[model samples]
Target: MKKWLLTTSAVVMMGSAIPIAWAGDGLWRHVPSTHAHSSARAVAGGPFAGHADVQHDWQLRSSVRVSRQVLREAYLASRAVYTEKLQKYAKVTPSQAKKAIAQAHPGMKVEDVQLRNIRTDLVYTGLAQDDEERYLVIVDAGNGKLLLDRLLPTHHERVFSGD
Candidate 1:
């Protein structure tokens, strides 16, 4: 009976420890990359020449942190692209940004406008008509601000081969 009781207690203790191990939830382990770029100066080296060890040595110390930073930058750039497209195509002015939003999206007001400035490699908003939603407008692609008109998305003119 004594041996059985000791065995049961040990099993019960081990089982209870499992839940405790899960408290970290693995979220901290994978901090995400965006967090690293919150402060641009936080990470050094060059446009993209820094070594992993160098970046890890900074305030952030994990791949997840670097990823979090990259994501945030991408989001910001996306917003900038949206705004720039609207302004260029729709001719939305800063003073008239609100008015354009109202006109483009009737009955529905602009909740918020985000700007994104992608890297030079990719097309600014894929070089299209630039308008995604009636409520949301791409004011200009150059500056990356929101606009007020019914901007169209990019329309690619395909080439016919061997006609």
Candidate 2:
């Protein structure tokens, strides 16, 4: 009876310990890549070069499972393509960009303005202060023509917030 009691206690203790170990392991498990394009190169040597590392740290800190590859692509694209397009296409001053955003989102202040090159279109993405919305004002960089004005999805508030 004494031996059987000791064996049962050991089994119970081992079972409980397994779950604790599994839980710890689960925290560090590799997250699957989200982007379909696996050929995308890892970003290096630019203003946004360390973006992947920063994103990894943020993922670990927040316990979020965001794909590192997606972050790397964004940095690579922005540095390699978007920045150049902005300088070439954007004839308007930052204040003018802000004014355009304000006009669209009436009663809301423009918090930030960033130029983006989405495919072939050059756009000014403006953040609104009140609802944390992003307004995409498409502009022709070649001739300074305003193309499209629209609001992106609401969830992008987190993206614009830099969180």
Please report, in order, the local distance difference test score of every candidate based on alpha carbons: 0.41, 0.54
TM-score, model 1 to reference: 0.23
| Candidate 1 lDDT over residue span 41-60, tens digit each | 43353323333322222233
RMSD of each: 20.8, 21.9
- Give the C-alpha miss distance for residue 73 in model 2, angstroms: 18
Best model per TM-score: 2
Worst 10 residues of 2 by lDDT: 51-60
Model 1 segments more than 4 A misplaced: 1-92, 113-134, 141-163
Question: Which lDDT tens digits does candidate 2 get at residues 1-163?
Answer: 6465455455545755765764554523444545443213223442223323222111324464447685555445444453654575567665676676677668876675666667866666666656555566655444445567676667656568875
- Kindly give the number of clashing pairs for every candidate: 47, 1
Error of 1 at 32 (Å): 18
